[model samples]
Target: MFIIELTYKVPATEIDAAMAGHVAFLEKYYHSGHFLASGRKEPRDGGLIFARATSKGEIEKIISQDPFSINGLASYRIIEFKATKKIKAFDDFAGDEI
Candidate 1:
């Protein structure tokens, strides 16, 4: 599992301008089963993405394609972790090792 944290470098107006393209990018990944969930941060500073990948390289490659990254609107921090425990509904994502 990977948690992608995006910290916006530009103002809200700039972020809003690219919102449509950003959403399109997210939808594409969601359809491909790469992204599980995503949303804006509490203070609206940026956003977060819950993604599933076999390796950090895979996630990085995908992140490079995000509109925010392309437009230099945000900086990203990728955190990878193993899910040792999760709800039964998430069993498929947690993997048998959990």
Candidate 2:
């Protein structure tokens, strides 16, 4: 399994557009079992998404196609890491083994 930390640089104008498509994209991934959870940062800064993917490249591709990216509402920084450990709530889904 992989953990991706995405930092979005929110731009004012595209907020609504980004949000409109965000839900749709999230639903698509969630039903497909890729997205685990997601939310915006405090102060409504950026957002984060925890996903399970086959490869780092796949994650990048997924993010690149997100509404934020497509509409240029936000820029993103992606950090890909191996899941070495996890706390109770997510323990069942954590690991490099998956």
Candidate 3:
């Protein structure tokens, strides 16, 4: 799994301006089964996304499509992790096979 964190690089106005496109980008990935979950941070300074990809390069390619990235409105911190365990309710995410 990957945790893609997005921190604002430009002003809030710029981020706001791209919110709709960003959301659409996210929805596209979600429908494709690449994203598991995503939302804004608690402090609203940025956002976090849980995603499944074959490799970091795949994740990078995916990130490149984000509106925030295309408009240079945000910076990304991509974290790759092994999904070794999860709640029974989330058994699909409990292995490294993803």
Each candidate structure's TM-score, on Cα atoms with residue i matched to residue i, is 0.92, 0.75, 0.89
RMSD of 3: 1.8
Of candidates 3 and 1, the better by lDDT: 1
| Model 2 alpha-carbon drift over 4 Å, by segment | 1-13, 87-91, 94-98
Residue pairs in clash, model 2:
none
Q: Write the per-residue lDDT of candidate 2 for residues 32-93, one digit (tens) a residue.
A: 77788887777676777888776877888888778877866676666666655667767565
Query: Which candidate do you rate higher for TM-score, 2 or 3?
Result: 3
Q: Which candidate has the top score in TM-score?
A: 1
**Distance (Å) between predicted and true CA of 21, model 1?**
0.5
Candidate 3, superposed: residue stretches over 4 Å from native: 93-98
Q: Candidate 3's residue-wise lDDT over 32-76, tens digit each?
A: 878889999978789999988889999999999998999888899
Residue pair clashes in candidate 1:
none
**Residue 45, candidate 3: alpha-carbon lDDT:** 85
Cα error, candidate 3, residue 15 (Å): 0.9
Clashing pairs in 3: none
Q: Give each prediction's root-mean-square deviation over alpha carbons.
A: 2.4, 2.7, 1.8
lDDT, residue 30, model 3: 89
